[model samples]
Target: MIKKLKLIDSKFNIENKVGMLTFCRNDIRNALTGSCIINDIINTVEYINKNNTVSVLIITGEGKVFSSGGNIKEMLKKNTSFSGPVEEVEKKYRYGIQQIPLYMEKIEIPTIAAINGPAVGAGFDLACMCDFRIMSNNAFLAESFIDLGIIPGDGGAFFLQRLIGYQKAAELTLTGRKVSASEALELGLILKKVDPNQLLQEAKKFANEIAKKPKNTIRYTKRLLKMGAKLPLKEFLDFCALLQGISHNHKEHKSALKNIKRKM
Candidate 1:
């Protein structure tokens, strides 16, 4: 059975084996640092990983902004996550907002970012963490941390470079420029762009497509893809062979074979 998640700053629902998490703190523009969004995200990812019934996850914001990243007001006041000494700040980061990326990386299911509006700083990094990004044509993304005299304290550099290569990632990071959705598609940063009204529908459609696949195979394939990025070719193939053996022995594999034979 799939477990119900108690998210403090977000809303979650499941349908057709696809779980959707919407950032609900539009009052603060879904800022990660000041609000409970980081905890919500980490918790949601953890829940999805353990829930075998869920095959894909779609994340988006509820209002005009996807996420404004950190709360600038809190930063100026040196309150909340931005408060305290250098050591204190480091500890906050290590245990607080930084947990999102760590948990996201370990998720076994496929993830999609439905960028409903501007995704700035850590917000952009959040989208980059997903396996796929479907953005609204009216929305934009920015690596705006440079403007604040800070860097991506949430592992943005690591994911961005892998998504769009180092040169493009460096240009965006150093310049802190806003990238339109169309431009993001051209740069290979986002998979597709749709009208604002169609963003969630399109994202759900994409999610459902992946969700329709054989359950265990989807998780295993996602794991293999992540391993492929860093594992040596021989090691990857060895792992793949092991998974293939397990997959072939599963009942789903037999059912799939029977279906194929019937069609033939």
Candidate 2:
């Protein structure tokens, strides 16, 4: 178990290959700033990745808010005398906002973003990076980066377009729209929406369903999905065909086929 430095005791539950990460930062609506989230996200992801015990991870916020984006108060104070005259602070930590999304995207294990409330800017991008998202009926997504006079530093452009289409993605990014839960569901931005009170429970149910599957198949599928974005159709097909051989020999795959034959 990796010890996370700044969290409130890492109080979460896990069983049968499903882990829950509750955002403990009750302050600032669970803002994932450099100091507050660096160790936490790293530890959470590492714990899930290391333990094959956990096949899926679910993330939710403490109260009504999922995340309020990066600490804008902290960000805007960079050049101010109150922020101190350290150039490294701005250069290093300003860039650190990019890391959380990078880590989220690189996770081999499946992830579920349980959007309990508003997820804006960095928060929205983080949710977008997840394998799937289930939002509360009261929850909303805010692509507020451009509204804040900044371009999204994360892989927002890449994943957003893939989730929705290019035109819709562009509209969201350019207009900095506050997309409601129902609209997000209708547009396929999220898997579904549950009542605010049942958000976490719904997320747990969703994750448990996915966690019951063969892990290797999920990982391979995620890889192909990522690869698909970068490769031509023929090349992607070739790669997938080559990759299928390993799964063809995998024990879970063999067992599934054998069980089907028995049933027949």
Candidate 3:
């Protein structure tokens, strides 16, 4: 078992192959900055990637907020994370908080974000980075960088457009409004919205269902999905055919087919 993390609580269930990570910085609504927690997130993702027993990762926040995104106070004071000159600030962003999205993009394990409360600004972008999102009915989300007189610095513009399409992404990012859970569902931003009390339970249940599938198949399927997002139709279809051939030869696929035949 891996040791518990400081800024994040990591729980792994070996029997079910599920890993849950809770962001514990409720003091500032889990606000993010160009701080050590960026490394913490990268390290956690790397740890989960290396653990073969863990096929899924669940991310949530403690208390009433998932994350407030960037530390606005720091920006206002031009201190702590935002004190440097323009060139220095650019480097800081490149080497610090930027690593989270870059590292998270590589994890092959299925990642789910269980949004327990308000996810604003970069916080909402973090959730978008995950493969899936499950929100508490009481939770809300906002691409609120515009409200702060800034832009989506952490890939919100790109990620949100991919998730919900360009027009809607434009509306949210441009308006910088808080979107309620029901509106999020209507926009196809989340998979499900359950009661706050049932958020983690429902997310874990879904993770377990996915984890029960053959691990290699899940990984390959996830890869294909990522590829499908980036590749042209013809190129994606070619890659899909090749991956399907490999999947057909997998022992897990063979066993599943055999069971189906036996039942028939």
Candidate 4:
């Protein structure tokens, strides 16, 4: 049986502030249930958002599969997880697993997904939600919800399209095909592919490079990128001006300018 989700606080090269969330249910390939959604993912992101000391968050699974997504046994039995009439089921989705992405959006820190193995169904969407992704050479991704007679319920439609474009997202979702690690890189879905044993190590190194920069600037830059992606050009420029004002006044910015002058 699966036990629990584990949160780890680690540093890379003694500089980066990193927080890791591991899916500890190795026995079942970290198949997600209602409890894991509420107690593990959503709750953990809440804490990570509050912890200003952490500049980056990395998510991974303990075993060969990143996650199997939903519990098949629960679906078969019409278990409380997905049970009830149509309206009730709709409400369950709105109030349940949907909260994961909603909370994930609120996090100011950058998130990196270290895919150590295959990520299927909603698991694929979960990795897409991250700001960056690195995969194990042995890993792959499958939008396998079509096989279950269901659609992407956990924001995969939105996330996947934004990452890999409409054509590729449609093909993956409709066909339920697996995209290998090399293909993921070629398709611009992941950053790098490494051996399974080095997945976390490389991810930490990547996170450290990002974390070494000004923390507040990194957070604000991420916020700007998200807003810019959806906002009108004029509105995005206005938003950038406002954030730039704040960034210019930050101590880190001031320190960097002073160092530049000294070198000059």
Which candidate ranks first by lDDT, i.e. highest?
A: 1
Q: In model 3, which regions exceed 4 Å deviation?
A: 1-15
| Best candidate according to TM-score | 1
Q: Clash number for every model?
A: 0, 0, 0, 0
Sort the predicted structures by lDDT, highest score first: 1, 3, 4, 2
Of candidate 3, the 10-residue stretch with the lowest lDDT total is: 5-14
Every model's Cα RMSD, please? 1.1, 3.2, 2.5, 4.3
Worst 10 residues of 4 by lDDT: 5-14
Task: Give the deviation of candidate 4 from the true structure as CA RMSD.
Answer: 4.3
TM per candidate: 0.97, 0.85, 0.90, 0.91
Q: List the pairs of residues colliding in candidate 4.
A: none
lDDT of 4 by residue, 120-223 (tens): 98888899999999999998999999999998888889899999999999999999999999999999999899998889999999998888887788889889
TM-score of 3: 0.90
Backbone-clash count (model 3): 0
- The local distance difference test score of each candidate is 0.93, 0.79, 0.84, 0.82
For model 1, the run of ten residues with the poorest summed lDDT: 74-83
lDDT of 3: 0.84
Tell me how far the alpha carbon of residue 125 in candidate 1 is from the true structure, in angstroms, after superposition.
Answer: 0.4
Ranking by TM-score, best first?
1, 4, 3, 2
Q: Residue 131's C-alpha lDDT in candidate 2? A: 85
Which 10 consecutive residues of model 2 have the lowest summed lDDT? Answer: 2-11
